[model samples]
Target chain A: MTHLVSIENVDMRYGGASGTLAVAGLTFKVDKGEFAAVVGPSGCGKSTLMRLVTGLHIPQAGHVIVAGQHVTEPVSIVGMAFQNPSMLPWRTTLDNILLPLEIVERHRKRLRAHKAEYVEKAEHLLDVVGLKGFGSKYPWQLSGGMQQRANLCRALIHEPQLLMLDEPFGALDAFTREELWCVIRDLHAAQDVTIVLVTHDLREAVFLADKVLVMSARPGRVLREHRVPFARPRDLEITYDKAFNDVVHQLHGEIASARRAA
Target chain B: MSAVIEDIQKSEPARPLIARIDWVRASPWLYTIALFAIWEASVRFFDLPYTVLPAPSRIFAAFYQYWSPIWKNSLQTLYTTTLGFLMAVVGGLALGLFIGWSKVIYAGLYPLMIGFNAVPKVAVVPILVIWFGIGAIPAMLTAFLISFFPIVVNVATGLATIEPETEDVLRALGARKLDIMLKVGIPRSMPYFFGSLKVAITLAFVGSVVSETVASNYGLGNLMSSAQSQFNVPLVFAGLLALAVEGIVMYSIMAWVERRMTGWAHRSTMSH
Candidate 1:
């Protein structure tokens, strides 16, 4: 299988007033249609790594290449979701989902004349995300879990080849989080898009991702990449499986080690 | 949990057919009546001099009696104020976006803008009168000077305060700089724009009035000045009342338009 996204020798540093690097010496890659998750303690630059692959931040050193192209600026072929979801309050759930289509080029020219067709597509996505009959409802009218579901749909609406999740389920409750893990699981299973998730939940990482990448604190580095030997079309019950728990326990210990080393 | 419970417990605050309204339901006329009762009583008991202040009843009569003159002067003032305000809106939005969009422009022009805005605009009334020679030009210039700052300040501040994640979302979608400006920058700034318009239109009225006070002899400002000289305080009070009403009317119109434009933003915030 070919790599859909690649980050090579990437170093990102946010300059402090006293002159210091924030996160340094990071490198990673996601193969086509793979669900990859990065797990670490907070401020470990997991988000920085996500930004790098999503073309939101340019690396100070090395390269970020996606689909055989170097990312000097932002690339439109990627979709992104964050912990906050941050849907524009002014727009309806359906309109928010179409936000990228209004911005990216190929979709822009088609938006006006084919608006109804695109709107139907957005409706279908909302339905798949368990938000059917909610396309016209405003963002403020939805619960946090529902809003995050809409956010997931919005990220997927443009159907980008690469999907980036920056702790996308961080704020939800345990139940809702697991529920969304299934939603995301199904989303990726159906779309087969490459997913890069930055997460703190070891169970979540193990349960959803094809491979899990562990990162150290501060100057984040890819300390380990564990390929899940578990079978896919993973049901929620798989989270309770001994093998699944074993992988989660193994990743958890690796993160504890990474934190102490940092 | 509490929120969900609250939603359930308070669900039937009103009946079902009303389409699930939560915040406000009573007719605003109740508040209006309360205000008027207080005003009517205060004037009756205070025994205020008619020259200094008139009773609501007297003001009502004045409202009716001077209707034609008031209307005429208002037309004149409106002409000046609207032209000036339009100019301000155009100039301010353009300058604000240009300054906001570029770091160099922001660095070069922002401080100077602050400095210019800080000067007391009323001082320019005399200079405007002297330069433009009254009638409508001076009044329009004064209105322009007064109304332009809020728009510039609000628009610049709005552009400056864009949410970082939204920018990130747009970037991954490969939005060009201009696309961000039109989609994100402009729409995000609209609340600021509408907020400024509320004050700007009022200032436009004030600017026109100041111009009338300094130079024009036929506007509402001039009519009030003449009424003051003749000790016809009721008419002066009436003029002020008329001005206030006009300001409210214009503000309401602008507000309605803003509500329509920013309905999306408003809806999202309300849910949270």
Candidate 2:
């Protein structure tokens, strides 16, 4: 199987020489078109890993390769969403989604000449995220869940090869979070894009990912990797299935132990 | 959800043009009239000398008696204030962007800016007078000097406070610094820029009046200073009243412009 993203024996540290080690000798590979989730105890550098893969920060040691290219600077083929859903309050929903297009050189040059076409593409992504007809509304006008949905649409608008979600649903209420899970599930299935989701919620990891990787506490490295054997097009009902709960419970236990080991 | 949209719309119902009295709109006028009435009553009952504290009637009569000079000085003050404020808008915006462009510049310039802002601008008027000589030029320069700091501070603040997550979203896509500024930084700072105008305009008026009181041959400040020497207390009050009216009008205009340009920033119901 072809690997879309690979982080090999990486070490990341913040500040200067006396800085804290966030991750060390960390390694993971995500296959093309796979849904991968990284779950760990709090402050285990899950967010640092996401940053490394996206080329926003270079690992102090070792390699982070995405789409077979070494990440030396920020790569242009990734899309990212964070927990805050930090939508620009000034831009309308559709305009917000189109923001990336105005930045990525491939689209930025053509966006003005082909404005309507790009706008249509953005509107379609919004529609798929269950936010149809709300494109013209400002972000503040929407509920938190709706703003997150717009955030997701913005991440997808550029048709990125890899999608990185950093606790995207962490701020939502339980019902809204589950609803967004289905939204993401449908999006992954429809777009055929590789996804790397970093989350703390074990059930979220089990329900959404094709493979779940658990990491140790601070100065983290992958402690274990578990393949989710569930079939494609999994339903929310499967979350209550005994086998599904077993996987979640197992991951929970691994994380609990990791926290204890810290 | 549709319910949220409905809630927003329902909260802001359209009012008829000839609806019953809007208490909020009428309050300022009612309070002002009441204040004047109380002042008039107090002056009459206490038999206070008009020279010490002029009655509203005497101030109005002085306003009519010296209408020509009052109008001319008022125009002069307005001219200097508006011109100085416009220069501040342009200069402050440029300097703010330059300061906000990098961490090094922000760190290097911030202390200097704070120190400059700390010195009383009234002191600067004399230095301006020495350089440019007395009159509207010194007054205008003082106005510009006094008003630009708030704009610089506010605009830089707006730029500096951009969410890191928002910046990351663009950086992941290989956005250049200019692209980030155009798409995010400049637009994000617009509300701050416009909001500062109201404050800067008011400060600009103070600046011009101070300079005028010190050096200028014209302006309401000069008129009031001259009237005080003559013991024409009512005329001095007339000049004060004219300055207050001009200040209110200018502030209102800035407020209206802010609402028109950056309405997106005011998301709270209280803003309405």
Candidate 3:
């Protein structure tokens, strides 16, 4: 199967830290409709990976090919959600969710004509995220979880074929994080879009990923990859199963080794 | 936080008998009535000479007596101030956006702004008179000078304060530079913009008053100056009161605009 995204020997380095490398010799590809997670310790360039995939950062060394095009600058085809959610404080919930559409083409052209339809779309997404009747409310009025849900909905609103999540649910409580994981899972399943989730949570990886790619500690490199064998339409209960624990333990061991190697 | 407002509200009625407690709660009418009562009583109680101070009743009588000329003068001042203030808004918004959006220009012009602003706006009215001459021009420029800085400062702050992550999000969404400016920068900075507008309005009023004090043959400020020169103290007091009333009316109009523009803020006040 043709991969939706192909990473060819990628290397990334931010100009800030003197002679420090964020990621090196990293290579991975996500197949069409696949859900992949990159797990690592703190400061392991997990965010850098997201930037690389989203075309926000150009690789110093190999190529990043997404949807059959080589990445040079930021791309519109990818939808992204950051850990902070970072919704605009001034805009209403619906307005904030429609932020991408306001800037993106085709939608911008069609916006004046199909404004009501778009509003209906945003409202439906809000409803699906359990935020019905909050379309008029600003970001500050909502709880952290609600904002994060809105963030996810915003990322998915344009229905980009590739979704990039950089620790999107890291700030939420355990319950809220799990709740968002289900929300994301349902979204990915319902749409069959490819997702690249960069997370530190092994349980999160095990719970939602089709394949989890483990990266080393600083100067992150893809050290190993594991295919999670759980059936489609994953539930919170499956995480308690022995197979889940086995995979988690194995991934935990790999992370421990990666940390020791550092 | 919510409890604080509720507690104050609940406590408002409990101790009712102590000198018309509910009267204070009815702040709108109570404020004006109390002010006029104290004003009239103070003049009467001290038996201060009428030339030094006039009773509120006398001022009211003077207000009616000079209704046409006084109203015309007031209108002229209002027109000049409003003109100057609008120019300031446009200039402030344009120059402010320019200076604010660019770090280099901010560095280039910020110090100059500081220096110019340091010189009291009124101090420059004589120069404005030299440049624009007498009548509306000088008065309008004075108002413009008075009010311009706050808007520029506030608008610049508003324009420049876009969150880094938001900029990043827009970039990732492939938004053009213009798109970022119009979509993210402008609307995001509205609250700060309104804040500046309020400050500018007051400054504009100050401008008109100062300008009229110097050059204008018309305007409420000119009327006040004439009253002061003629030593008609009650008329002077009446002009001052008229200015106060005008200021309140102007403030209320702007405040209403603020309310309409930012209705989402009503959610906060709704709990009250």
Candidate 4:
């Protein structure tokens, strides 16, 4: 089976020739419709990896291929969400969600003709995230968690084949984060889109991903790749299992050592 | 914020008639009324000469007597200021977008703009009169020249402040430079644009008045200057009062527009 995303022997250096080497010799693959998570210590270039895959940065020494084509320019089939939702303060929740549709080509061309249909779709997505009746409200009217959910809806609105999330839940409270994890889990099952989540939360990774990859400190490389043995339709009860804690603890030990090594 | 507003609305049915008046919001008007009353009383008690300081009653009398000329000149001043301000909005938006679009343009044009803005606009009036040959043209151009700088600077600042992460999100979705600018940059700059309008409107009035004083035979500035020459001190004070009233009205309108256009920004920042 062809992986939806493949980064082969990728090396990324920030600044010029003499600057910091952010990531080196990194290789990873996520199968089509699979969910994968990358966890690492801070400054381990996990974000650099996201940039490489999203074609925001061309890898120095290797190639990144998505949907069987090399990423020379920004790949159009990717959707991204960052830590800060960063919704435009001017737009209503529904309008903000519809933003990508106005920019991406196929939808942009069809937008005026199908604006009501798009609004229906956006409102439906908002409902899915428990944001029904909030379509008319502006971003500032919503709480932080609500704004993040709106941001997620904005990212997913175009229904890109691949979704890249960089610490999307980092700013949320633990309970809200877990609530979003369930939302994301249901979204993954329903949408069947390939997802690559870059986060520092071990439980978040284990609870949602099919596979979890841990990286070493600066100039990051994949230190370990573990297949999560959880079944589909996971519940919060799974997190309390001894097996889950063991896996998290093991990964935590690995990251601690990686930090010391750096 | 909405919750509090809703609570007030819900409880309004039970409030007494006098208590229902939004006194907190009306405080500015009340304070102005009280200040004028005190000034009228003090002038009457002190028996001050009108030349040193006109009493509020004398100022009102002058206003009544010169209503026709004051009305015509006030209209002229308003027309010139509004026309100049509108031109500035258009010119400044284009110039600001041009300057803010790239670091190269920003670096190249910013210093030149600063130098131009630093040159006192009053000194530029005689030069404007020489080029445009007096009348309302010089006044209008001066207002345009004075007000355009703030709008340009503010819009540029707004456009230049797109968060890096936000740019990345758009880029990863295959948005081009122009796409990012139209979708994100312009809308983001609106709050700043509206804010600049408040400052620029005031400056436009200053420019119009300054040009009128030196170059024009119409407008409140010229009327005041001519009145000063005749030593019609109360009429001069009335002209000053008319100008102040005009300024307040225009400023309030701009403030209302700003609140309407960019209410979300203020709401979020001020939210508990």
Quick one: best DockQ, which candidate? 4
lDDT of 3 by residue, B1-272 (tens): 23212344546575544443454356676677899999899999999887888898988898898888789988898899899989998999898888867778988898899898899877888888888787888889988988999888887888788877677777888888788888877776676677678888888999888889888898988898898888888888778887887888888888788777866545534533
lDDT, model 3: 0.85
> Model 3 chain A: which ten-residue window has the lowest total lDDT?
A11-20
Off by over 4 Å in 1: A16-19, A110-123, B1-68
**Candidate 1 lDDT over residue span A1-262, tens digit each:** 8888888877787774454454677777889999999898778888788787777788778888999899887888889999888877667789899999998889989999999999999999999999999988877888889999999998988889988998888899999998899999999988868898988889888888989988888878888899998897888998898988988888888888877887
Interface RMSD of each: 1.9, 1.8, 2.8, 1.0
Question: Per-residue lDDT for A167-238 in model 3, tens only?
Answer: 888888999888888988988887868999988899999899999999998998899999999998888999
Clashing residue pairs in candidate 4 are none
Total residue pair clashes for candidate 2: 0
Which lDDT tens digits does candidate 4 get at residues A1-262?
Answer: 8889998898899898998999999988999999999999999999998899889999889889999999998887899999999898878989999999888888999999999999999989999988999999988889889999999899899988999999999999999999999989999999969999999999999999999999999999898899999899899889999999998999899899999999
Compute the lDDT of residue B90 as modeled in candidate 3.
91
Candidate 1, which CAPRI tier? Answer: medium
Q: What docking class should model 3 receive?
A: acceptable
By TM-score, rank the candidates, best first.
2, 4, 1, 3
**DockQ per candidate:** 0.53, 0.65, 0.42, 0.66
Ranking by lDDT: 2, 4, 3, 1
Residue A164 in model 3: lDDT: 90
